[model samples]
Target: MDKNEKSKPSYNQDIIKIIQARYGYSQDYIRKSIRGDRTGIICIMIKDEYIRLNNEALKVIESQLYKL
Candidate 1:
């Protein structure tokens, strides 16, 4: 299938919970950030840092985010 037609990965709740537990970030904050909502400055910073450290993770997250 073409890139546009390819099925995107859905949000993995287990991964989300793991991230939340490890980073101590609230689920609401993460969800909002993924949805491109304006979150706290710290939340944005943490998200950026996470993306920087894990490029593959960012891809999954972005895929899920865009699916929302």
Candidate 2:
């Protein structure tokens, strides 16, 4: 799979809103930042958060697989 495009179990507004609420940024700005449409300390922070959430989701999936 492409590094840029994540597979299923993707993120949604709930996760985005979590970051927005925590960091005090607009949902549009956070979405742009995650999409690599912008750059800056704030953008970097947003991207990092997105990656963190993605990884967390992956771990949950992995654990479910192991339960089989």
Best by lDDT: 2
CA shift at 60, candidate 2, in angstroms?
1.0
Candidate 1 structure, TM-score to reference: 0.42
Top candidate, metric TM-score? 2
**1-68 per-residue lDDT for model 2 (tens digits):** 66797564345777898898899989888888998889999899899988898788779989999999
Please report how far candidate 2 places residue 14 from its true position, in Å: 2.5
What's the CA RMSD for each of the models? Answer: 10.9, 6.3
Which run of 10 residues does model 1 get worst, by summed lDDT? 7-16
In model 2, which runs have C-alpha deviations exceeding 4 angstroms?
A: 1-10
Model 2: how far residue 55 lies from native, Å: 0.9
